[model samples]
Target: MKLSKYLGYIFLLLATLAACKKDNGNYDYKELPDFYIDTVGVQKTFETPQSIGTVVITPKVVYNGSESNLEYLWRVYGTTADTLSREKEFRSVIANNPGTYTAELQVKEKTTGIRALMRYTIIVNSPRPYGWLVAYETQAGGSTDVALIRSTEIVKTITTDVVMRNIYSEVNGGPLAGTPVSIVSNVSSPAADMLFTSQTAVRLNRPDYKKLQDFNQLFVAGAPTPKPEAVMEVPFFGNHLINDGEVYWQYSGLFIGKISVDTKGYKAAPFGYAIYGKNGGFYDMLNRRFIYMEQQLSQAATYASPKAGSTARFNLGNIGKDLVYVGIGFGQNGVSSNPDTYKYAFFEDIDKSKRWFYGINFTLPDQPDLCMVDISAMPNIFNAKYFELGTLGSVAFYANDQILYNFTYNNATNTASTPSVAFTAPAGEVITSIKLLKQPGSGYTGTESKSNRIMYVATWNAATKNGKVYLLDANPTSGSLMATPLKVYDGFGKIKEMCLKPA
Candidate 1:
């Protein structure tokens, strides 16, 4: 009986151990919490201050187990420091300047001390405001250089060389075909609009000035035709012309590749004498013809020619177009509310007997005929070499080697006042170019207003071998318009061209 009771106790102990082990081995099925972000494999943009990303938890479970206490954090960094930090899913950021940035997101299970993290990259950009650009040609090698001019104050100044020595390599990786004529910026597209250079008419990008392409390759497409000798932007019209030493091919704008106007090719001056009007109409000197541009590439069917049996009413019987001098005489008021709606033209015909035409209505069909003015009233009419029309339609100034003449026009009666000497150059000097500096309206953002009229005259003294630019008041009361120069800019070999850019 004692032996049986010992075995029974041992059996009881063994049964209790087996029951405990089987109970622990078969536990109920339950899953732990997991996390993931939905923003993976996607790109985003932030133009303004807004949430850059929203972190989401995947297979989200109710607060229980170790995940009962959780934490979320987001951070952003720039080059120098941590820019932003947040404790929630929606992480927001703002960058006023342009650059690259980094962002990070982290989530942690506080009880278990386990964490999950993610990283991202971002980019920011700022808008480019307004500025001006100037072009200079050195007399040493006739090399053209461009300067960017910016002004925080009232005075304008050159800030940097926008296009350095890279202009040569930008165009076909070859040498410049000719002297640089001009540099023009497309206002419509500040970033993509190509910077136009006269040297080979190569278009360059705005930021790095990388070569985009040339007009020759884009237009001709590897054809056998000779590339343009030079490309120049016409003042006020924003139109560009390609000269092949014979004819001038013009385009509506650089954006459009179509050839807007193709004149009859002929040998003449380097750039032929063509007076372009506000409307796409031009007077050709060589052919003695007038081509009116109704729109882009619209010069094919109808044109004004002096040849017999033409549709145009006006005819040049024996006069030649080359021996003529043209200038915008005045802008007059029309019947409409807009001021200065009517434009009058002035041209001097250099025939056997020199004659001046003033107050001529070149745009009106009824008054298309040219009438000679009795400029004999002016004593120095015989020596006027270059001329400039004043903004005030009735007045104009003419210049010779030594003196400038001021002539007044009477639009009502179609006559002119007696010409008087307005300015006298120094001994052995002559005026090379005379430009009336009106406020540059097209793309200039400078302090110089149209109200503050100014005149820039470039003079060359052959004997002294020096070139000087004289700044004068357009309208003065003391004696003459250019009685004394307000300022003089020297040290230039020759002031070939002067263009105004805004700052």
Candidate 2:
């Protein structure tokens, strides 16, 4: 009886021990403490900047314990690799370079020794506000050289034979072949941010002002091309086509396009008109005569209805082939449905001291026209001297040796007012070039209506052999057309031409 009672007690004790073990195993499992970065992975992308721009990274931190015990660290790599910062709130990180970058934030709890990491993607871009590219010319020992003005106002010369060098310039493609007749920008798209120069017809990237490719690279099927006298882009029928003199190169993004002959001209208007000086008159390339372009994107050139005032035929002789001086601006009235309403292109004859204005009209497709208006009758007008169109439409400023005249156009009456004296440069100082800086960056914005419009006049003192640049207040509405200069920059070498690249 005693042995049986002992066995029962042992069984009861063993069963009790098994139940306790099961209870302990169930109680041992506890929920994990939640701590993570609250930001979703989708929020990891960042835009790159052109310069050393600041990037603020504020990641949401989800912690279960005391926040003071947590340490934060941010690391950035790729374009500019480095430890960005250590503060819990990431801010003021400098993204100074252009490229892809990877950023990681490490959050560590001191007491618990718990660490969490979050990664992000960064993309840096060198877009607009890319700074100014100043195009200027220098002459020494009978050699005219071209130079680029950096956004820092630092003069950089590409020509090796020149006396000075543009020490700060970043253009590494090579020097320009000859004197630049004009620098034209590709305005239709920023993806193809490019500029074309008249001399050698070289194409340059806007980002670094470097040569985009070889001159022949722009040709179709790698065919040989003649040295382009001028290159331009014309937007019509919702598409852009490239024109370099007589040849036509269509733009299909970056490395693809069709090359063929469509029009013949050294200059073209933005509104699809090819202008060439031939037989003592303006030859319209599209119409194969002195006429306007009627069809859009069609190889067959057509003429507009022959209105008395709307014919491309002109008797002007040997017009300036340098489209660099051509000015396209708006009329006093807004963009007219006439297509010719506010559109005017001013040109000067190479053989004579005469100015001809070509008025564009597209009211009637059948009546598409380029009307020639003679502006040579204006008094004291400089025939072939430095003439510049102001940012504001209908106003043109001319420089004749030492005099500056303003020629205002009246869109309401379709007439150009008589030329008035705007300013007389200092005595004994010859005006080299007249340029109006309307915007902050390179390329024309066509809206230089800022009251602070400054007319940069490059002057050379023959007596001193010194060059000076005068910044005159160019507010025509200010009543004083010949007001004193707001600032004069002296001490640089002789400046023959001035072009502004925005800063």
Candidate 3:
């Protein structure tokens, strides 16, 4: 019979055979091959803290080489490898979880029995936070070597930004909970495309205003009116920026809400301009409710209250996204419902003021690696800079230490560009000892005992060229000075400032 003619019959026969196939299924079950399992098989390992690992078997793995069941099993010690088997698994473990381990597989090939195994060990851990970091100086010192850097906080590991981050808050922490404070960031120029890197603040003079009121009411025996410089010492640091939230101010008895600082030319100066908003988050640990403050009725034509009267805006620089800058300027307003508000902004009674803005500018030194700042490559901070100015978080994070004025200055413009005068100062040098002290605004300074001896690179006030050199102390008050006056060239005419190469 022709195969085509009997095709249906043949199919039926094959089906019957398949259907009748053994209930005990299979020609033969392939068992894993057995090669004496070596005590030490292919293995990989890593160290704690940080690690990288690899594994190698005795006979280097070969493609299409092994004659076995062709199976791989990887296990992490106590766990079962059969449960977790993927084509290829890369086990990246942190340094903290450490142990010895192995990956074993039982292989068997019916045609040719062959067997092998592989394993690797790994350890992991989180990195430790450094309590102190070295603060390198880009300007304002007369040393040729590394300087001292102290801890900015007693407790550390504080996340730099809160939510929406600003410049000052980017560098420092946020405005404290209790006290009412406001911060700004990434303030550039609406007209000029620039970034702001400087972190600045402001304080209101309430006590002084009360004192002044008392002075005006003096009956020749009443409490003396306090001076603007005397009563208030409320310090406002650049707090973290809030990408979202309304502003608040601490004025007029209660927490006044709906007050914010709007800064133009925020970090986006490269493309266009950047602006920022900020508010005081009043934390009442006792009361529990976040009592907002009032709209800071800025009565002065200051930077904070940049209005028609005054021009106190200073250029920080073309700030980049790495770090943001924030500043507070004061404006003047005629006495009204609250005469006290006038005193908060000390600039209201300016005899003659310099057009110095809160000075925010983004700058890239010729060598940022040496100084550690990229003026050109600023980070992108749009949501934070404009929208959530009130949120608190770090806008910029430094790998190690951070110092102000890290980059070199170009004297193209005298604002901050000028190196300034660097003449030998009078014997009253602040550095009385060679030991260093980390300052908040200023950099490390020599200790009282040792500072007086070591020489320093410094700028001097000029035109009234006096040979006398006075060490600018951390405090406005003239602190201790060196016993002997160092004879140095009148640098006022030569260079405003000079950086000392590491000696």
Candidate 4:
């Protein structure tokens, strides 16, 4: 009986196998369409400026399939991936920031569900890459705007100058919220432009001038009071921000990171100077002294008591006067000289009756004081509104109302030249801002003649409610302004501050 059951099971398996072999399949098969993109004449890379009209790119797509079944797409990859077009040709204005980007083109066949892709390198340049960044307040002090005196040449002669007004508003869609105070460009690694106002502060990306971070995002701990004073940057060293008389700093690096407050418990003056290979210098308003801080450290310390019996002109730790202006001074020999070692600090007494100029070799270890002289006898020293150190020579420029005066100081003799009129504005206009067009990096040698030999003077007229910016050629040795300006840009708001933005 077991043998018979086994035979029956084998017979059943044989019958099932025979039935499956007799059946045949019934399905249809079709070949996929062949398609390719012809890149023979297609541009593989594109270089354009921001808002330079339209950037058109036409590609030749070869396909053996139906043209109606083909779909096209274009995209650019930056900080964020953005779709540019859906047509076969890319015809649109690429107003991306001044940086490198990757663009992609995708062609798809709907019927075959197949796609082909090609990538391209895109470099967007800034139209106003190098210029004079002017921050100004609108009429009635309602808000603030920024302008750029666009330059055509990067090095050599400045062929042309065009004033682009409302730059911050043109890019940001509105004005900065508050009265303008200062505008500074950090021409170091991870370059940025810091704009300060009474109510807020903003950091803008360089070249493109796009907003990167605001006050809250700039600080690691949190935003401080909105009394923004100044933002200072020492190329390749560090950056410092003065807010509410407090100092916050960040070391120079690949990224613009958050800054931490200096915990030394000192009130820093609004303006300070920094040397490339040495510690940064700042005036301690509360202690009435000078303090120095290393680039990598947060705590600032006073310079060691000028050796015990040293004939130091003035003690660095005990300069009991109000700091009016402090800056690195360039000698008459231009930037080739050891200008980094020379520093100047101008001060005033408590009653503002007397002012003094202290020339020091900041790089020296001890007794850096070169000379100290009372500059009160100089013309317009008592009622000067704006002060600027000359980019070359031992000279200084100060403005009193509409009159701008220039005087040379002799560090060796502890004497100063008689103040001479550099430029006089119109009768009704008052000098608002004066700045030397000097950049901070050693790599700017190619453009030294243009950058280091120009001065900017901004004036405002109350009656006409007009503002004007004058670009004047500066005498390298005498630090005197040319009788006629190279160019004059009018039709602006009340100018508050101006700084050089180099390429």
**Each model's number of backbone clashes?**
2, 12, 96, 0
Q: Look at candidate 1 and tell me the lDDT of residue 493.
A: 38
- The 10-residue segment with the lowest total lDDT in model 1: 265-274
Count residue pairs with overlapping backbones in model 3: 96
Stretches of candidate 1 off by over 4 Å are 1-137, 146-199, 202-238, 242-252, 255-279, 298-323, 327-329, 333-352, 358-362, 369-385, 440-448, 461-466, 476-482
Whose lDDT is higher: candidate 1's or candidate 3's?
Answer: 1
- Candidate 3 off by > 4 Å: 1-26, 29-31, 35-45, 48-121, 133-239, 242-503
Residue 116 of candidate 3: its Cα lDDT? 52
User: How do the candidates rank by lDDT, highest first?
Assistant: 4, 2, 1, 3
Per-residue lDDT of candidate 1, residues 1-503 (tens digit): 99999999999999988877745556676565565544644443333312222323232223444544777665666655463554544444443244656666666777556666666665544222233333334444345444332332213343431222223233224433444454545544122233333445555544333356665643433322433432333344444343443333344344233333454522222232223353233444455544343434433222433444534334432224342344444454323222323333334454525546444334553444433465644666656666666654456677777777777666556667777776677887677666665444323354444322556676767666565666666662111465777666554434344444421
Question: Rank order by TM-score, top first?
Answer: 4, 1, 2, 3
How well is each residue in 1-503 modelled by candidate 2, as lDDT tens digits? 99999999999999888876644444455454578888765478887553334677788888877888889988887645588789987666343445677889999978767788998887877533333233333333222223433322222222221122331133442345444344444444323433333333445555434456644564445533433333333332112333343434344433233332244433332223322211011233332233232222223333333546643343222222222244444433443223323334555555556766655433343343245557778765544377666444557667678888877666445566677777777887888777776553333233533322667777777677666666666664322354777566554445554544332
RMSD to the hidden true structure, all candidates: 13.0, 11.0, 22.9, 6.2
Model 1 lDDT on a 0 to 1 scale: 0.47
Task: State in Å the error of residue 317, model 4.
Answer: 1.4
Model 1 residue 376 lDDT score: 43
Mind giving the per-residue lDDT tens digits that candidate 4 earns over 88-188? 98888777877788989999999777898988888888866667788898766768898888654223345566677887877677888998878877655
lDDT for 501 in candidate 2 is 37
Q: Of the candidates numbered 2 and 3, which has the greater TM-score value?
A: 2
**Tens digits of lDDT, candidate 3, 282-356:** 212121112222224422111222233433232112211122222111111211222111111001012221111
**Each prediction's Cα lDDT score?**
0.47, 0.50, 0.23, 0.76
Residue 116 Cα positional deviation in candidate 3, in Å, after optimal superposition: 8.2
